[model samples]
Target: MKELYLLLLCMVTTSLGKNKSVDLELDYETASRLAGLPLHCAHVEYPNKLSQVLENQTELLAPSELHPIFYGCFDWHSSVHGHWLLAKVANLFPDTELHQNVRTLFAQQFTEDKVATELAYFNRKWGKSFERTYGWAWLLKLQEELELFKDEKFQEYAQILKPLADYIADLYIDFLPRLSYPVRVGEHTNTAFGLVFALDYARLDGNEKLIEVIRNVSLTFYTPDYDCPLRYEPSGYDFLSPCLQEAEVMSKILDDDLEYSVWLQKFLPQLFAENFVLEPGKVADRTDGKLVHLDGLNFSRAWALYTITKKLDDKDMVERLNAIGDEHIRTSIDNVVGSDYAGSHWLASFLFHALETRNS
Candidate 1:
């Protein structure tokens, strides 16, 4: 049995390298490997920080003790998106061991009681920014994935997680109004990156208020922004393109194709050029957590470019962007498998997001 599994894994890995199309889907073995990562770490806690404020003695607790459902993959947001990756893979390969692993993990960790404990941490005095918008966005993305899965077990998991999801949605509605300015950083706290995922979930779940808030806030923050200075982009530790992230959110918020085209023209006019080029971000050291973020930057840039292409009607432009997206994916998709723990722990989710966006 072990030899058979190894043979199958090798076959899948080989097939992945041979198929280099822009629409390349994650084969079962690749999905299983990526899903296996989170499954391996979902419970192993030690290299963990609560990212919380301690109001009392009880607040100083181990990660698993504090966040029963999300205490692994090095941090809160990574753990959340790790679960998202698992949920995605399980849906893709429902009859495989990947599904069984997700089922077992969800059954053990996604109980209402566990989620309540997770929620309690968020309700703490200094918890308003616990995971801030990044973690909150991913939790909603997980909920959206769960809601989409037709399996009864996934539906149950969605129901179990709905309260937490609802809380995050409410937080967005309350938080966005009070947020005077959007965080335009290329890292975790970037407001546009947060809104992109939250808006996706809100639209899918029919949360009118949440959708309205995101749309309004996005336009307010990003509209009239011209000359985004892509040349000055990619600060040393950036995992996201601040300029592209803004473009991503605005693309969703604006409904009119012409208006969006006009907005993109002003927002990222460089893209409108006939021979525009965006080199994939380079990572100096995969073992260095911050440096490895460049890998993620490549994937995210691909996602943003792919998303922007959807709103455009220019066939040549779309084709060019699609090729660029493929270049970005190729640069990092291979690195995802054998990178240092710093990169391996979370990069797969970004890769999955990029590929999923391309295939969508």
Candidate 2:
């Protein structure tokens, strides 16, 4: 299983070929642009979403008052991953002006007192399920990037955030067992999408308990599943592909090459056949907050396709998958920047993660 994880990581970070399908080169120019998305919004705390449960008048505090660092980017989860996006770009392109800007942001947001306040927010009864698995997953992923980043400052920041990260981890350890049914929606509540990054953090942290629980829970929820209803996807306001996210989680859990193949064949048989092809989702309105999710759907599908294709042994199938993933990315990568505040507030992280899986 550990070997499978290592293979997946290698495949995710490697280029498919010299003949690229999209112009996703994360040169300093592109990285800086994507970095600008989070940088611009991470501090702009208005037009925010709390997703909170107000128990008393005191609970009506503003978003920034609730989560200082994760208060911008429209919502908590977006801002959490927004920080992850900055950590990623800063690590990839060091000594740049944006890198220093990221450092400054970290210095301001990751202070011990601020993180403690953030932790206090989570402990409230009304806030216990604040972001549930979605925001929890992104927060852990941010911790992963902070610890992975090779810098003294980043290490200190990671320590400052460690208490909250550990708290979130405990929440996961406690929550998974109580979840009798999986959330299969193509939205923030999707259980599979929530597990992807959290699992990544578990493996990175060498938290064997977390890895074991995720593997066990995945097996229980998905092992017997077959013939996923993938065609019925992108229901109106979806930022995620339920079928693809589930497949990605399965790809992570099932270790044996042939075991994964058999499972995938039963679950999404269309992948192995050349007659069926996946297309990028269309968004009718980028200005509408809900409608813009299709743009995110396209990028998310790219991430899943890029990672899932690496599990296949068939060379031709791999190439086809790569092409599909590239097209999905191409369809939305350029649209992410300056699209609309609705989409622009959160789409760059999706685009960045997808591009990284394809060696951007």
Which candidate comes out best when scored by TM-score?
A: 1
Alpha-carbon TM-score of each model against the true structure: 0.94, 0.93
Error of 2 at 204 (Å): 1.2
RMSD of each: 2.5, 7.3
Q: Kindly list the per-residue Cα lDDT of model 2 for residues 1-360, writing each as its tens digit.
A: 223223323333333222455466667666766777788788878898788888889888988888987898889889999899999998988887767888988999999989999999989986678888999999999999999988899999999999999999889998998899999998999999989898999999998888988998999999999998888887999989989999999999998878999999999998888877786888888889999999899989998988898888999998899888888887776677656889988898998898888773
In candidate 1 the C-alpha lDDT for residue 148 amounts to 91
Error (Å) of candidate 2 at residue 360 is: 7.4
Tens-digit lDDT track for model 1 on 1-360?
Answer: 233333433444543442465355767756765665677767667687566777889777788888888988888899999999989988878888768868888899889999999888878788877888999999999999999998999999999999999999999999999989999899999999999889989989999999999988888889979999999878999999999999988889889989999999988889989889889888888889899999999999999999999999999999998889888888777777555778877998998888888887
Report every candidate's CA lDDT.
0.85, 0.85
Which portions of model 2 show Cα errors greater than 4 Å? Answer: 1-22
